[model samples]
Target: MEITLLQGIIITIVIMIIVVDRHLEALFIFRPIIVCPIVGAILGDLNTGLLAGGIVELAFAGIAGIGGASVPEALLTSVMTVVFAHITGNDVATSLALAYPFGVLMQFTWTIRNTAFTAFNAPAERYAKEGNVKGLMKLCFYGIVITMIITGILTFLSVYAAQAPLKAFVEAMPDWVINGFQVAGGLLPAVGFAMLLRVTLKGKYVPYLLAGFLFATFIQIDNVLPVAIMGVAFALMEYYRSGEKEPVTIKGGEESGI
Candidate 1:
């Protein structure tokens, strides 16, 4: 089945049909796992979306936010990569490059949504002051709904719009441009690492960080199985050392310590 360009765009738009996670109290259309495949399947390129998504997922698998700081925006990156890949004939690496910038840009979108929610916070505060459960309910629902709906619509629209310019841009550029982008792609992990370092670069953990990175970069132990093994080994060793206990023994009414 041939996928018309407009149909591709519409498929991207369907990403806006978001389902809320009642447990988390946050809004998103779908998990990246779900979203990426859908994008690819719609574009008649599910394999491409899955592959690119797998790369993107692994790259940021360790990312998380602590103490109200920012985290790498995976959702935006995933969406952009899928849309851009579809537009650019689904080049995996190129989709990565296109998605990377959007992640950075989406950080600002994060700020905006957070800032808008701040206003809603004030109303919630007022409700608390007045003991208005209904007010709180209204504020929470409105905040979550409005933010998510706006986010979905905007993501769908921007990604849909971005397709044309991205296609045109790729088509117009010389091969050298893509080559340069590829060279940059080799360096892209540094950005994720730098963001990671902001949190993980403790004096005590520096050696572990260096060792893990070296193993990943030099020894090529980055695949899931090897990394998992290393992680389990590290955890076990740490536990053994930390769980050391004094030995106690008693023989024939005499107590002895080894």
Candidate 2:
């Protein structure tokens, strides 16, 4: 539960790298599913980290930043949730509900950062017009570096400085309040999936969805691997069927083929 100084430093560095990756939109490692396990490993609680990551990933699966719209911060959510769960020895659900506010706070910070970065546009244009490649590169680099540093500091503070207070807050909460958070956290993933289905589901896929639901709900499988395998098989079948060409028929008879 106690996060050492070295662990905090490592986590900060990891966060900085993730933030850079996010800005670059490269590798896609900023997702909770990826980052949570890594943070957990650093904290010597890989299993809890993985569990938290999976839940948080599903909960945020349908949420994305489109155009100027802001979404919850997955990186902060993943980090804080894992840290809190490990620190408090609480369920991932409770940790997720608690850590979500940090995600919102970081989202607001991200919006502000983006707005401020617009100030660099004029200088960037001047550097481009003057063919000062170094200057332009420096301008861009500075923005990324500043973002990394700020995010790292915030993450460090949230995990290190805020841990005691957060743990105290959780301890002070009533059983009903904690239970409510757990329930809400458990439902979030379903809500996220529904949001995704709303946008992507088609009439043709209804059967598959129903089948999956039945298998998952009634079949009482130990894990989802079998269902996933069935899905893969169905997908392959669909792919091959779609690729098959239908036989072409002539308008008249074979005698008219001359």
Candidate 3:
């Protein structure tokens, strides 16, 4: 599927919006789960977009930019995965495996951008000291605009310009290699979940986790909606139970200060 200029422009604009929103930490739509579907809609392949998004979302579930730690670029990976899958007619797993390198590349780019942006700190401080509101506003505006433009341009080039080469590379690969990618991609979500559990799992939560696993594994259902609802119900019950106050007991089993 060849991407037209108009579609490329629209996708670029959407990427710009997502990137700016990510920087502002507003709306929280920068995640792969949200970004991929939107891009897929634009590309006229919502199913592939949804599939790619879900897999990538779970794979990166435990990963986040905490404090000074660096994380892979989820937005770029999602966009490229959807685009590559749609254009090359590849499986979601293979697309995800292929798109991961792009995410790492963008991660490096992000680090460089952050380092470069430090130069603006001096100007920002000077404007603050001089009480120049307009100057400060202009600086912020320029910073956002530059970020938006750079992200948009890079996304466009990656999606449009590299499509042919990427498609060729995928086509040239052997069946075993493709299968290996599928295997790796399929394991990534489980690894991500394990990482999350390592951090958040507790003794009290083990039972609930086991129950969920049983429900998901032993009981075959059309969807996981029932299991999800059960989880929510348990969570609500625990919340309310925790909020209740225990009755006070006196020496003779009588309430104190009654």
Off by over 4 Å in 2: 244-258
lDDT of 1: 0.64
Q: Per-residue lDDT of 157-249 in model 2, one digit per residue for the tens?
A: 998878889888888999999889888889888867976787667766777888888889988798789999989988999899868884574
RMSD of each: 8.0, 7.2, 6.5
Query: Tens digits of per-residue lDDT for model 1 on 1-258?
Result: 234657645664464453234113266334456667777777777897797677666555455444545765666677777777667664666667767777767667767777767777777888999999999888767765765676666566557655666678777878888777666655665666666676556555666666676778777553657756776888798789768873563433222211
TM-score of each: 0.75, 0.88, 0.88
Could you tell me the lDDT of residue 225 within candidate 3?
90
For model 2, the run of ten residues with the poorest summed lDDT = 249-258
Question: Over 4 Å off in model 1, which ranges?
Answer: 1-14, 17-34, 62-72, 201-222, 246-258
| lDDT (CA) per prediction | 0.64, 0.88, 0.85
- Predicted candidate 3 versus true structure: per-residue lDDT over 69-148, tens digit per residue: 67788889999989878888888888888888888888887888888989899999999999999999998898898889
Candidate 1 deviation (Cα RMSD): 8.0
Scored by lDDT, the top model is 2
Q: How much is the lDDT of residue 96 in candidate 3?
A: 89
* TM-score ranking, best first: 2, 3, 1
Clashing pairs in 2: none
